[model samples]
Target: MWAMVTLDGLTVTYRDRPTLHGVSGSFAPGSLTAVVGPNGAGKSTLLKSILSLLPIAQGSLQVHTPRSRIAYLPQQSAIDRSFPITVHDCVLLGAWQAAGALGGLSNAVLDEADAALHTVGLCGFAQRPISALSAGQFQRVLFARLLLQDADLILLDEPFNAIDSKTTAELLALVADWHARQRTVIAVLHDHSQVHQHFPQTLLLARGVVAWGDTAEVLTPQHLGQARLLGESWDDHLHAA
Candidate 1:
């Protein structure tokens, strides 16, 4: 498989504090991989840095795919549901890349949006307000949006955090579908069981990479223990410019 994203000695800082330090790895094209570690392990920071959402203090970060071809699903907590938008509109937003800034959606795009909603089991919720839906339902809506994106690379951060088991299963199926389509998928996950079950590759981090490679090998007890210790010992006083 080809490398879709590569990071070499990548370092990211927040408020003069290093969130990711000398992190190096590559995400293979068409592969399903998970980023897992203890709290403050820089899991989310890695994703953001890949998307160029954070300032890279040093080192190199390269993405083979174009920015327009990338789709991102941030953690639910980062979204504000109070925005006055219906589910249909929210899903339609995914078509923005194709529709362009002032381009209007034709009947075909509308049809695709409807189909995406149905695929995610949100057919009747198209006209429903985003603020009115439960956490699980909103997640489904986001999935529908991603469906319309047809992106080459998908990045998900804590996708199944608070959802029910059924929802998690349903969402995992969509992830499988993406993998089957040969699209690259990288997700930040906390559940070791889920990572072991679905993701073939894993990258363990603690402000820096503890291990990276096959999920089973990288997630060993020793590696996990070292990651936890590194995360716990991270000094907030270390300043990086």
Candidate 2:
């Protein structure tokens, strides 16, 4: 398998305190990886570091995407809630990387955005103001934007938290389609059962990598116990093995 993202001895800090410690992993293309860990385990930190959104405190991380290779759905909390951008404009921004700094979007880019909105079942809301969207709808808009980006590696933070069941299903289906097309997916998931059901690979973390491999291997009872000990327990039985 082709490694789309690799982390070696990755460490991060916030306010002088370490968040991630000596983490190492290689994310392969055409595979879905669920990043599961207790709160404060640095799942979001890891993703941000890989995207270069946050400064790396130590270690090394690399994302290998061919030109237009990476797309990201940041934590909902990070989004500007009061921003006045419309859904269509938000999705259109996905093509900005391809458009470069000086170029305007082409008709093809708009078409791609439309297709992405349709895929996320949000086509009709294209003209709606972003602030008018519910949390779930907002996430859908981000997904639409990701589709427009046509990236090889996709990273999502807490994707199914507030979405309706239908939207959740659609997102999973879309992710599966991306995997089928040889893209890599890394999602920070809260639901252990859902992680096991939907993602073949799992990364169990607690300030560092507790274990990473097949879901069955990483989500074992021993690791769950450790995670729970760290007060990160949420449905420990769901991932017990």
Candidate 3:
């Protein structure tokens, strides 16, 4: 598989405090990679750095996608539910950025947005207001937006944080389909069990790279312990079992 996004010796800081330090990794096409760590582990920061949402203090980061080649699905908490927007409108917003000045949305863009909603099993609620959606349903709307982006790389931050089992399963299946279609997925996940169950590759971060390898191997007790106590004792578990 081709490398879609590559980061070498990447570093990021907030308020002069380093959040990501000397992180390096590569994401390939048709791959599902998970970023796992405890709170304040720089999981979200890493994704932001990749999306260029945050500036990199050092190191090199390369993205192979075109304008819409990479899409983002922010965490539910990041979304403002009070916004008076319909599900259809929200989904259509994905294409608005790419829309031409021909007035209304193009047929192709509308079709794609409809398909995205359908893919997430929210076709029936397309006209419903986003504020009326449940936590899981709201997430599906975001996923639909991701689908509408038609990007080869999708970045999701804690996508499964507060959803029910059924919705989580549905979202995972959608991600699997994208993977099958040769799209690359990078998600920040807190649930270790979900990482073990769904993602094959894992990037464990702790203001730095704790481990970056196969999910089963890197997410061991030592790494967990080190991640749990990142600022104080990452070296202790740097090479520990």
Each candidate structure's count of clashing pairs: 0, 0, 0
Lowest summed-lDDT stretch of 10 residues in model 2? 232-241
Specify the highest-TM-score model's number: 1
Cα lDDT, model 1, residue 173: 98
Residue pairs with backbone atoms closer than 3 Å in model 2 (clashes): none
Give me the candidate number with maximum lDDT: 1
Q: In order, what lDDT does every prediction score?
A: 0.93, 0.86, 0.86
Cα-based TM-score, every candidate: 0.96, 0.91, 0.91
Model 1 agreement with the true structure over 1-241: per-residue lDDT tens digits = 6599999999998887888999887998999999998888889998898798988999999999899999999999999999999999999999999999999999999999999999988878989999999999999999999999999999999999999999999999999999999999999999999999999999998888999999999999999999988865664333431
Stronger candidate by lDDT (1 vs 3): 1
Model 2 segments beyond 4 Å from truth?
231-241
lDDT tens digits, residues 1-89, model 2?
65788899998889877788899989987879999887778889888888887888888988877546888888888889688889999
